[model samples]
Target: MEKRYASIVFRHLTADRLAIRYPGLRSVPFVLATPMHGRMVITAANALAAAEGVIQGMVVADAKVCLPKLVVMNEPPGLAQRLLRALGLWCIRYTPVVAVDPPDGLLLDISGCAHLWGGERSYLKEIVTRLRGKGYDTRMAIAGTIGTAWAVARFGKASPIIANGTEVEALRPLPPAALRLDPDTADRLIRLGLRSVGSFMDMPPAVLRRRFGGGLPARLRQALGQEAEYIAPLRPAPPYDERLPCLDPIRTAAGIELAIGRLLDTLCARLAGEGKGLRKAVLRCHRVDGKTVQVTINTSRPSASVPHLLRLFQLQLPRIEPALGIELFVLEAPTVEDTAPVQEALWAGNPGLEDTALAELLDRLKSRSGTRAIRRYLPAEHHWPERSIKEATTIAERPATAWTTDKPRPARLLATPEPVEVTAPIPDYPPMLFRYKGEVHLIAKADGPERIEREWWMESGEHRDYYCVEDQHGKRYWLFRSGHYREGEPQHWFLHGFFA
Candidate 1:
């Protein structure tokens, strides 16, 4: 394959007036700031300030003095990151392999994709035009290597340059600063009588290496296209996906199922060829009018077997109503795992068992009752009965041990704390009689004055004296009395948990 690459550069990106348009701050001398001591410190200067002779690193106060019209907006790291990520995702429309060059830039390996967009120049124009249409000031360059592309995009002539083997000649007229060298290095290169890339290229390799270390020569080679560069294309995450654009929209359930079956066969074949399996799948049915209906399924294990996957899909197919006829069908797997060998049971029986059936049942329940509604209880690191249990997403397999006999825990736990009327002999004694849930229950049997200290570091902290009391009906309740006897306030008792 031929070597081809493109670097999309958004220059003075932090200072771009278009970007400053956010929050309606335009023509205002603004600087991007990184947080320091609860305040923002200027890092990059806007063009307006540069025209006014104000430079970066000037304190917000001093910058204001220089340009009274200065509009200093606190740096938004998150907004900048989101913009970069959006750009990166947009690049996927051109090539699946797009790497983010943060703070504002993208590196795209458009090797075999340029032809699809009608060649490199047209593709470059399309990208720049589209971005400009979206209110972004973008400049792009296409070259053999990343270094050369970066150099040209940052320092080449006003227009986007597409150089093939003439990268050195193409780059020679540009200034040495185009190489993205450190400020110190660029100053030294200038001191050494090298102003442009041409001056640096004229120097002997050995002399450049001796003076600038190993990096200078590598950069030189990269710019000259003498050294090869490889791009790790971001492959579309696996467990193959396929989409079918239907000419005649299908509305009936049977028609939808048939279309899904065809897509599943293609997806399964691709997965089998790649030696991978799908752990989860999503089917998006785009309607003719505009809406989208999505149905998804997750499996206990990775399985690309067509029959098994189709069966799972079949169970979910009825839920998707093609209201206005489905125009497109897209199958995608968001989660995938390796199809590892299953260890055969010592008894040599089929893998289908009660646990497997139960896992599927739970999955079905989760699908109908909402994934968040069904959960498993896990023990938390706390001695307080109410704080000891935590709810987590139910996993396919249960832990080896469900109950722990190592420590005594309440058999029942309340959903929420209930207030209890208590009268105890002392702060250390268990409550004698407690009115709970609108009923006065005399403590027929009781144990414990378990002292659980408040987690003082936590915002919601409470100091309580806990007790386990068995009522006349044989039901047990875990109650806690807040505050010590010496504390002036009357003790507030609460029933925190229960026992079977």
Candidate 2:
């Protein structure tokens, strides 16, 4: 099969992105500026600014004189390159062989994949439509080679899609800059009456090399398809992806169910063979109408159970639209983990290291009421009571450090302790009575003055002397006296938690 490539260029990528974020800048004259040579200079300008005679490399003060009401803002660091990289990653959904074209462009090896979107025309339209929807000003071109695609995207007519074996014709009328030549070289060509690519491309190799540098001829041959050029495309992230192509397009709900089942089975088998499991997955259906429908599922633990995953998918299957008919099913587990094999015991079966029932219950609860409905906490090795525990991702993970046995902890912990007025002898005695929240409570029994020092590494604060005391009603309370007691100062008391 013949190779086909597509290139996308964002003409004013940074300025356009800024306009999208700040919509008012789209119509108003605005330039992204940075300090250069002790003067604020224009790094990039929006379409509105450019139309008002403002351009890059112009000093901001001079630019303001050109458009008196111009708005100048600092350009985000590496703005163009970052946007290009992000867009390159997004293009992976179309083709896996996508490469970054530096500051403002991307090269895609569409190859045989274009037919899936109904042809190169529809494929190009889809890409452009999505980018325009994202509020970017894009110019795109598709052709037989990357060089041809790159040249046409920047220099050819708007939205050009040239056919295979026509690169020479497509590149002939373009300026010398279209061959990726520097300004000095292109100016030299223009001075010699060699304005277009065709005018100087046919020149003798030695003459061209002597007149310009060796780079100009090499780039010209690359664009003309005379020399083979290889692109080190960005390899798509590895996915535990399983795909199923139907022999005939199926439109019925039952057929869709069966396709999902087959994909789940295949995916589960593969995951099991690899000794891995999925935590998050997406089911993508490629409908015959050139549209895609997707359903996502998340598990509380790394799971390979086909039935459990199918149940989760069934809950979201009604949301899929089978417009004409579905031709392909793709199940991708974007998140996976190493799952140890279960060793069955002689008397009973084992569900790996943790209880599977609890995991299943959590998954079901999360699927119904959302992930926040269920949560488990693990003990952290922090001396501060409030920072001693953290949310646990899975039940199988054990705490690295044991809970502190030196001090008796409360059953219920409060985010911040409430202030309590206590009547006690200063310095070394427990509180005899305390007024908490509007009620006075008499201490029937009490145990301890456990001294806990403040964690100076995190923050500087007062040390605490904690005491577990029972009220007249037998309800136990955890109280703390803050700071060291001075001879003439009264220490502040606080209610930190409750003991069971």
Candidate 3:
């Protein structure tokens, strides 16, 4: 099959992305600018801003002079490249061969996949329509060659998929820039009356090479499909995936279990050989009637234990309907982590709560209560009590620094501290009595005024003086006062949390 390529040009990718987040800007004139020297220079502009005479590289001041109501935003660095990369990754759903053309375009090798989406026209239409629905202004073109597709998408009078062997004719009317030439060379060509590609395309290769260097000829050949242009396609992840196609459709629980066992056997063997394990795996069952049913399992640790993983997926088996019988089964481990080899006991040993067993238990808990229900926390070295503990992404991650345990901490910590009214005998002394949650409590005992300074790097004017106090009812509470007291100024207090 001839290699067919598609190019998607995002007319104003940066501005459109910003407009989606702030929908009011979609219909209004706005420009994303960068501070060049002392002046704001337009980096990108919306359709409305472009219509109002604001173009990229123009000074914001000049643009404002022309359109006084133009809204200007300081463009965030890498916003364009990041959004472009995300869009390129999103295109992988259509074709595995997707490459990002930096700043504002994506190249997709739709060679053998056009038939799946009807044809080249239908495929291009579906892609463009979906992107427009997501608030992106997109123009696309499909052709037998990558260069032709790129040129047609960008500079063609009207975007059309060029037929095979007609690239030279189709590219003749476009300017020399469509051939991807250097600005100076293109300007020289224009000055010499060789403005359109056809003016100099048929000239002697040696003559063009002598005037414009080798780049111009190479590009022209690439666009004409005379030279192979190799585009490095982005590799899709989930390198650890296994599929099982049943000769006979399976509907019974036993058959599904058997199929799952086979998949797990293959997947685990592969992971074990690679010395890596899965943190998350999803099982997709394609039904005979063209429906899909899926179940997912997650392990707290990277584990390649087959029985343990099979059990985790088993707990989720009931969730899969398989309404019309499953015809194909695909198990994909999208999330994986490298795990160290398990050390075996030299002699007789307990082997109690080992890696495999612990992983199985965590997986079971996750299956029953859902993934978010289970959480792991580790100590972080910090003087601030709240910052002393942090959530651990995985149980295997160890603390790099020692944890601060010099001071006593509350048994229960509030998500956010609540305000409380307090009465104190002295400005520096702990509170004598406090009113909290519409109830008054007499402070029978007090422990601390552990002052924690604010991290000025993050934010200023944020400090707290914490105190652990026991009330007359024997309920202990962690309290804090914001800032120091002034002789005539009012004081601020808050009930942070409770102690056991």
> How large is the C-alpha RMSD of every model relative to the true structure?
9.1, 8.1, 12.0
What are the clashing pairs of model 1?
Answer: none
Q: Estimate each model's TM-score.
A: 0.58, 0.62, 0.55
What residue runs in model 1 are displaced by over 4 Å at the alpha carbon? Answer: 16-24, 27-42, 45-68, 77-79, 158-164, 225-265, 274-276, 282-296, 305-366, 370-500
Note the residue pairs that clash in candidate 3: none
Order the candidates by TM-score, highest first — what do you get?
2, 1, 3
lDDT of 1 at 428: 79
Using lDDT, give the best candidate's number: 3
Q: Candidate 3, after superposition: displacement of residue 104 in Å?
A: 0.6
**Rank list by lDDT:** 3, 2, 1
Across 1-500, the per-residue lDDT of candidate 3 in tens digits comes to: 89999989999999999999998897789999999999999999999989977899999989999999999999999998889877886676567679988768999988987876788889889899989988999999898898999989989986578889889888999998887777898898899999799998899899999988998989899999999987777755458888786778899888999999999999999999999999999898878665568888888778888888888878888888888788788889999999878764642253543456666787899899987877667787566666777887766677677766578788888988899999988877899999998899999999888899877775788589999999998999999999997789888999988898
TM-score-best of 2 and 3: 2
Give, for candidate 1, the lowest lDDT window spanning 10 residues.
347-356
C-alpha lDDT of all candidate models, in order = 0.73, 0.84, 0.86
Q: Candidate 1: lDDT over CA atoms?
A: 0.73
Error of 2 at 165 (Å): 6.6
Off by over 4 Å in 2: 7-107, 117-142, 151-178, 182-184, 190-207, 224-275, 282-301, 304-333, 342-353, 363-384, 387-394, 404-407, 425-427, 484-488
Give per-residue CA lDDT, model 1, range 1-500, as digits (tens). Answer: 86778888775566663454674544566677677776556766766677787776767777778788877766666765666766776666566578777656788987787886677889999889977766566888988888888887777785565557777678888877777677777788888888888987877899988988877787788777787766554445343577776878999988888888999899888776676778789998877655668899887556777766777778788799888798788788877667655443752444443344455566566565666766677766766555665775446344443545554456666677788788777667887798976788888888877788766666466677777889888988888777677656677888887777
Maximum-TM-score candidate: 2
Model 3: how large is the Cα RMSD against the reference?
Answer: 12.0
Error of 1 at 429 (Å): 28
